[model samples]
Target: MLNVARTVRCIDDAACEEVQLFTEEDGEPERLGEYRSVSGLRIDKAKVRDARVFRLWGYHIPIIVDEEIKAALEANGIVGGKFEEV
Candidate 1:
């Protein structure tokens, strides 16, 4: 278990061109098919430095977390959520 406290921060300098913008279909809001995959995700680490948790603009389905948070969750036996590197 991590003995140190973790502070979550939010930064707006992250950018990912690979993610497709969400769109509406049949009057229902939906994300483009491409957004379903996180392959080729490119985020500028310098922009989001020190941020332990954050969500990208226009895409909120997956809440991004840093290594510390990930470890904490795993150490506590968190379930029902998938963790993928950005």
Candidate 2:
């Protein structure tokens, strides 16, 4: 199973005002997507949704954010924070 750390960091690859998420699959890092944001570090819900960041175990959207962010995302109809295999 692939696991991404909850910590978010900024990439310094000359891409300005955008955040990039690189997914590690099979020991290879692939560019998931690049999202444009005002601060470029604060990942918003839409970008998360677009990137499908919560998905794991073959398309299940897992809860990956903290309570406050989880609550806010849930309020907006995004399900996620704790995850388990069934």
Candidate 3:
């Protein structure tokens, strides 16, 4: 099991993928392609998606963000919050 208590510490370095503007109750994540294959993605502090911060597993992720959400993410500490890319 992965101990999620540590933010930077993870079981494996995998690039984060874009889930969705809103998470589906079914616990499914939406996939977005990436430009580069990466172990993990650090959430952009500036682009806040919503109450929850979004993270991608790696660098060249192909997920698109909403205009408003992108702006908010950039302006906030979406990276340091209660969310991490798996």
Best by TM-score: 1
Q: lDDT per residue, candidate 3, 1-86, as tens digits?
A: 11222121112223343222223543434533322244344344343334232233433232434456556876875663332333
lDDT of 1 by residue, 1-86 (tens): 22333332222223444444345653435534324434355556676767677765444455777899889999999887688666
Give all candidates' CA lDDT scores: 0.55, 0.37, 0.36
What CA root-mean-square deviation does each model show from the true structure? 7.1, 11.6, 13.8
- Predicted structure 2: lDDT: 0.37
Clashes of each: 0, 2, 23
List runs of model 2 lying over 4 Å from the truth.
Answer: 1-63, 80-86
Best-fitting candidate, scored by lDDT:
1
Number of the candidate with higher TM-score, 2 or 3: 2
Please state the error at residue 32 of candidate 1 in Å: 13
TM-score of 2: 0.22
**Superposition-based RMSD of candidate 3 using all C-alpha atoms, in angstroms:** 13.8
Residue range 3-66, candidate 2, lDDT tens digits: 7534323233343354334355434334344332223223334334433334322222333444
Candidate 1 regions exceeding 4 Å error are 1-17, 22-39
